[model samples]
Target: MTTRRTFMKGLAGGLAFCSCGMLDAASAQHHAPRRLPVMVSGKRIRTVDVHAHCLFHESLELMGDAVARILPPTKGQQEHFIVVENRLRSMDAMGIDMQVLSINPYWYGKDRDLSAKIVQINNEKLAELCASHPDRFAAFASLSLHHPDLAVQELEDAIKKKGLKGAAIGANVGGVDFANPKFHPVLAKAEELGATLFIHPYRLGELASRFKGNGWLANVVGNPLDTTIALQKLIFEGVLDKFPKLKVLSAHGGGYLPSYAPRSDHACFVSPQNCDPTIQLKKKPTEYLNQLYFDSLVFTPEALRHLVAQVGASQIMLGTDQPIPWEEHPVDHVFATESLNDSQKAAILGKNAAHLLDLKFS
Candidate 1:
């Protein structure tokens, strides 16, 4: 019989796990073992993609003409979210048994009424999709950060009423960094409810001029930089202190922060006058990474290895940025990380996400 230890090892460097999720170890032996992926005792390993994206075409109506310029047209690739079978096929191909769906905020710049309606529709659809395929799909609810009080209710409703896994938010609302005290109620509710906040970056805003000409530098450099700035604001301005237990997961492997965090440990010291003494941080800047979470979207095994070294393997989870192909061979990427042993690989693959999101295998 395959023990949990050996099965997880198989997941890392050998065979893949179930295409259809397997049950808990305590009950797996009662049923026949599925050959597609390995099982421990009776439980099969799970592969979850936490950085997948989706959009409700109907919601775009609210954007009116602005979408043509503001949004990338959605027609290029046939979407997996529209066809459940297609998503399952894609997931099976990538060795991702499940994907946690999210829609990056397009409503951030819109007025309150418009943003609220758009968010309502997006959250309802996200919950609907997850409800349709509980095993193969889950989602983070969309929020309207334009109104923090409203966002608080949206988050509560999403988790408690709709059963979404968490809330997906942009790194900043337009250009307003989340560290501003205005957004605290939402953070407080998330901490109280133990909801994971998935931070995807967008809108380089003032930096747009510098990124004007290039090989998609707008996204290539902007996304990660936006995320890094957002995180730094929270850390430097003491937002993390106010809500120490916030379950924040940063996309794009936590942007550039994990790669260059220790430098922040020195910023306050090198320029002591620059940092506000009134806002005292509980830990060194780099140390806060231990309290945060990231994805495995960083490209190379070496990059992945470095991220693990900087923020421990437990802080990283599998992310594909799926439907966009930022990571086409995600499963292989994790298995190829020479620095990670089976347990660390297993944790990064699905265990960390399962624990962070409180995923219940069915």
Candidate 2:
């Protein structure tokens, strides 16, 4: 009979709240801060971050003179160059027990041979790093997605041999959308292998000019929009129907889709001409969300609650676009969601990720 409010009130004067120890976010910012573990209803919980970004130094070498083309070894890209112990400490402070490392694909435009070599090297480096700290890290394999045939083999080798969890993909490969049938073979392979494809949003490219002024809209607006377009293409073009079991998880709460997904449900009804009469979708546009998984990187309790409202909590998992510093306190972010019960909080923290990725931890 105990309500969630009183249950939270029963804990540490109702100030420590839901066990993430956020008691005072303001003061904690200035202080050394707490390295407390995440707990729900007095029980400790494991936290798995499915969206932490990383790039290997050796992989950068493949670019040679063109290394600066995409990432440029910026201060952000240099984060992993430090000792791994430092990263572990950062994870400890943030209450993350495990992170699934991923590298954003930059060689999507590179030639097939060069791109394949880059993927092979990066996947090896990722596997080595995960091998070093199996308890603290797992990784998604890098793939030469630009070439569908090579990607099929790369994914198999990375998962079957290298022991990676899955693969990280940009919203689009070069300018091509996932809906393009050319990539169907890779999607089919992923479904057959049950490999989760983590879709991290990337730059908007051609759309950058409009997002010019302040606020980094180029990223803030563009990245999520990129993901929205990618997901929509899969849904509207019948790609999801072709490969219903394809495991896809999108970063930043699957972009703006969840926010305005219902709007899409009415699109085919509102504008009959544009809705393709030849290809009928099996499910309502919004219903497609039920099959998709998303990272909890929306950045606010209310926002997360809304996302969960749209797509059940079972479809959400913890993520921090780490090293870039998008959501530093992801544990606190989960604990702060008033609408979630302790069970749901624990699931979002790590249980769901473990189930989805087949991860194991003591």
Candidate 3:
């Protein structure tokens, strides 16, 4: 495995000279003297990226040396996850004030003991990162949902003791959906604790055979598809109904479901047989869409506008799947969108997330 010293040497060796302004901009955002609540448009906007990621060196070491080979390389051949310099540079360039980091745990298939250890390592690192850089970084805890009881305890500790913002979870636990009664204990605990659940895709294992292509359709289509399915299960099965106070911030613009949610409402009306008779709902499926939240990672001004039109602006927050080069200029994306007014843009950029995350700017 590459040590931090070795990686820093590589960063210096292969890197070409950049403008001092850019370097200072990256270094200054966190360290520079400034008032709190980060003003924008002559008002306190406080831009926050609800979706960002990092990798801890200790966690990687625990996974062993061969695992490091699969990690993606950043622009300067730096390890994308372990190196913080590029992340800070990108955040500075994007004008993001604070980023909420999550690990998106890869230990779902590991044995319970190993998975628990991974969760502990990830949460501890996340806490340390947030503690060290309180201005620029906050984080969600990693959970081993296969063991729901353990997950509940871990989440409680992460929020109450470690000061993590919440928990980031895959769309499903193994093949089981979030709507499963078995998972309700964890969900109840999250709702009870007022934890924000960041639902990211696990990659579609069921669609593997059909997703064969050069375009990475498995992710392009399958990632959103998994999120869509997971969300539908929550909606159609009344999981959201059971926990109306639960704060769920869906990744990838709440998958394709928000844009296509009206179809779900129509389905139950047109094809009663297809709808589960046992599962009764008080509101239309699309109505439940408003009760949820989404990220502005749709990648187009028009797409962002449509999402706002579908679910209203207050339910959306800024999310850049950073370190992946997806939606690189998320702040600019919101600004370029013509449909949203200044107030709506401000809310999506930060205020909404501040309320959900209970962030208190100092």
Candidate 4:
């Protein structure tokens, strides 16, 4: 039986031939090549990016002088000014069909009320953008986890009322780790609603002072480490067991979990006393890693290949972490990866995301 990957490749080839109408000429060409084959399934596979960020002008206005106060806008920091229109242009250039717009979690500070307001404004704008350009955009609602009740209210409003596909949550909320019982109600609500939760990392303010001299070390290294820690907490604390229906999509390819699963499993087996009693997992901690979704932002082909091997292509989707310094050309990056066949590449580029987001593209 042909796998999903092979079937997609065959479909892509058929669509390409029907559209081009020069299969014989293409096959006969020896010296120079004509148009290359489309890399994904369907005639126009909606490249639904599960992870793309946008900051509206209103949000910037809300920030008011705070933006300049935090970090002066420089050449490389142009994405800081990326509004909805600017993000749309970037998506067009990158061949992304619909972007699942989210706001970076940096704006959430300790003040619960202020964070709720910020999330409200950002999520409303995101909803409006998706409504206005239904073909070009989808959205993931942002929540103020600092205020769980308000966050849950906003989530219900966004999904049931605004028709948002999912939500974007930070690894931690005002220094409170996500696995803490305080956040269980929020997780349960997400599971009940059947909404995906995209987990992004924010710079741990408490840890930033420790890396005073290293520029971006707190963001680059600290952020992924924070993700690793938060995920492990959720697993070992049995949060996953409580809400097995929760659909989580982790950024940066789930940080170090895939690489460090063996050690975690060994520790769990060898020292049950050290492991949390709440964790009643039937398999190793790493086995549950496949239950979550991941983005194709691992940077290198080898890394992407390893991720596919570990989690399989169906759980992988395209993500650019848009308007961020770490963002790469997602389409080009996947195309260059020699390890994936045409069909697997197509799935990562858009098919998986389209299915996850419940997007309808003709």
The best candidate by TM-score is 2
Q: For residues 1-362, could you state the per-residue lDDT of candidate 2 as single tens digits?
A: 54433432342241211113333453355434335577688987888999887766566667765554555323344464435877887788888999999988878888999999899899998898888899889999988888999999999999899999889988998778977999999899999999999897756778878998988787788889999999999999998999999999999899999999999899889999998898899999999999999999998888999999999999999988877666778888887788999899999999999999999886
Give the higher-lDDT candidate: 1 or 3. Answer: 1
Misplaced by over 4 Å in model 1 are 1-43, 70-81
RMSD of each: 11.2, 11.0, 5.5, 11.7
Local accuracy of candidate 1 as per-residue lDDT tens digits, 228-249 = 9999998999999889999999
The residue-by-residue lDDT of candidate 3 on 1-362, one tens digit each, is 58545554454454332212222232234334222344556886788999887766566555553454434443322333445565666677677888999876677777788878889999998898788778788889999898888899999999999998889999988878878998898899999999999999985777799999788787789889999999999999999989999888889999999878888988888888988898898788889889898999998888899999999999999997766667656776776787888889899999999899988666
TM-score of each: 0.87, 0.89, 0.87, 0.83
Off by over 4 Å in 3: 1-40, 65-79
Provide the global lDDT of candidate 2 against the true structure: 0.83
Error of 1 at 130 (Å): 0.6
Give the worst 10-residue stretch by lDDT in candidate 4. 15-24
Q: Of the candidates shown, which would achieve the greatest lDDT relative to the real structure?
A: 2
Residue-wise C-alpha lDDT for candidate 4, range 1-362, written one tens digit per residue: 54444433443343110111121222233212212223364454557677776665455545544544333232224454345576666676566777788776756664776666677788888878788889878889988777788778888888999989889888887778888998888898999999899988865778877866747577667878878887888777788888888999988888877666667778867887887685577666777787889887787777888898888888999887765534435676676678898888888888888888788754
Estimate the overall C-alpha local distance difference test score of candidate 1. Answer: 0.81
| TM-score result, candidate 2 | 0.89
